[model samples]
Target: MILDFGDGFFLRQATVADHAALAMICLKTGDAGKDATGREDDPDLLGLVYTIPYQVLEPDLAFIVDGPAGACGYLLGAADTNSFNARLVSQWYPDLEARVADPGPDSSRWRGSDWLRHKIHHPDFAVPQALAAYPSHGHIDLLPQARGKGIGRQAMAFLEQRLAASGSTGLCLEVMPQNVHALNFYRTAGFKVLQDVGLPNRCIYVAKQLGFAPGVAG
Candidate 1:
């Protein structure tokens, strides 16, 4: 275990065997930090797109949040966004595109998990120039049972330390503009909103500088 939160909650390195649990957690907290089970038809698609790839492609930075019941959350990161995006395009997306049919470009006719299906086929691997300074990126999600117990704070600190130890000078995360709680949490965690980035209307980028000492191995 990487961390023991006590009361039967802990953090551990995630493995491929935990894919199902990760998918369920992704679906449960999929809708802008709310449960999206009712809205998604193919519930696992969100995890396939967002969470699973981290464990498969960057295992060192992927971890699971386990409670008494089971895996309830995840912390995932990419130390280098450019390399990670390239790997996703070359090694990950082709297989996924073949497995999932495109839902087409028309949003009006889309339903259920159609949006995610479209994203799979037409994946965007671009990293905005504004985010170039923060070349590393991360994601963290916790179920309600794991929140309010200082888990999120500890998890973020853990991720930051990992990235810093790996020589990452900066780290960034994209949050939905509507998720006020997340935005606030990030701000409280020392992340600042990046201004003047030409991102889509849906995204808000928050970033922080990492203190990487020389000669440290991740």
Candidate 2:
């Protein structure tokens, strides 16, 4: 199913060729659901950590929303969280560890590239309960220009179908408590709060089963 935007948008499987453009979109919408063109100097921080690796490891699982201008949004992640996280730290993190610059002493209040760099060294996960119950996860980012186009919902539904087909029983994701819009979207998408988390970061862990109620849509 092609989830198009306006009259000219369409969806396609993300390829290596789209890496740079996808990373740019990740940066453009990195600031808590807003445009952050000047928010950080490094455009690869978020994508390198959260996005690029997923595409690199599981190319077919990644998809992009394309428009006349360029890539406007994308859904990138793995089907199995436990395995994906293990591979990420053991295999993927090592590659990024050498390149990601260290965060300063006051990195606690940092955002954008600085905070992203910090996270590279200190990987975070959802709460234990959530992790045990929902073993698949990923993230989605849509540029401001892509919002209100129903692309988010379409992208999510497509992702759910893909995940369910992959044999994932459930999916999970970590969201910052402050992103109210995201929280609402997840709720509408059939995700429920699994629990509150405060380990590596203060956030709420949300989840959805794959084949039933409180589940990802068809």
Candidate 3:
């Protein structure tokens, strides 16, 4: 176990066996930090797209959040966003594209998991120039059972330390503008808003400098 949060909650390194649990957590908390089960037809798509790749390609930074009830959340990171995205495009997306059909560009006809299917076909790996300074990127999600107990804060700190230890100078996360709670949480944790006009309408990037000094261990 990586951390023991008490009350039967803890953090651990994620394994291939934990993929299903990670996907479930992603689906449950997929809708702007709320349950999105009702909106998804194929429950695994969200996890397949967002969570599993981290475990497969960047295993060192992938972690699971566990509670008394079993796996309830995850914390995933890529130490270098550009390289990670490149790997995804070259190594990951092709197999995924074959497994799922594109829902086409007609947004009006897309429903449930169709939007995710479309994303699979036309994957966007663009890194805005504004985010270039913060090359590391991360994702975190928790089920209701794991929320409101300081797990998120601790999990983030753990990720930050791991990144800094690996010589990363900064970390950034893309959040939905509507997720006010997440925005507030990140702000409280020392992240600052990065205004990037090139980002998609649904995205707001918040970043923190890792403050690692040369020749010093994080």
Task: Identify the candidate with maximal lDDT.
Answer: 3
Q: Model 2: C-alpha RMSD to truth?
A: 3.6
Q: Which window of ten consecutive residues has the lowest lDDT sum in model 3?
A: 209-218
lDDT of each: 0.91, 0.76, 0.92
Per-residue accuracy of model 3 over 1-218 as CA lDDT, tens digit each: 98998899999999999999989999999999998999999999999999999999999999999999999989999999999999999989999999999889999999999999999999888888877668899999999889899999999999999998888888999899999999999999999988767766778899998965455322
Give the poorly placed runs of model 1, Cα more than 4 Å off.
Answer: 212-218
Ranking by lDDT: 3, 1, 2
User: lDDT by residue for model 1 over 102-158, one digit each (tens)?
Assistant: 989999999999999999988788888877668899999999999888888899999
lDDT tens readout by residue for model 2, 1-218: 35654667778888888888777887787777666668887877667776777778888788888877788888876887777778888888887879977786596667667777777778764336535556678788887767877888888888888898888877777787878999999999888876445334566777787865354343
Clash number by candidate, in order: 0, 0, 0
Report how far off residue 122 is in candidate 3 (Å).
0.6
Q: Could you tell me which residue pairs clash in candidate 1?
A: none
* Pairs in clash, predicted candidate 3: none
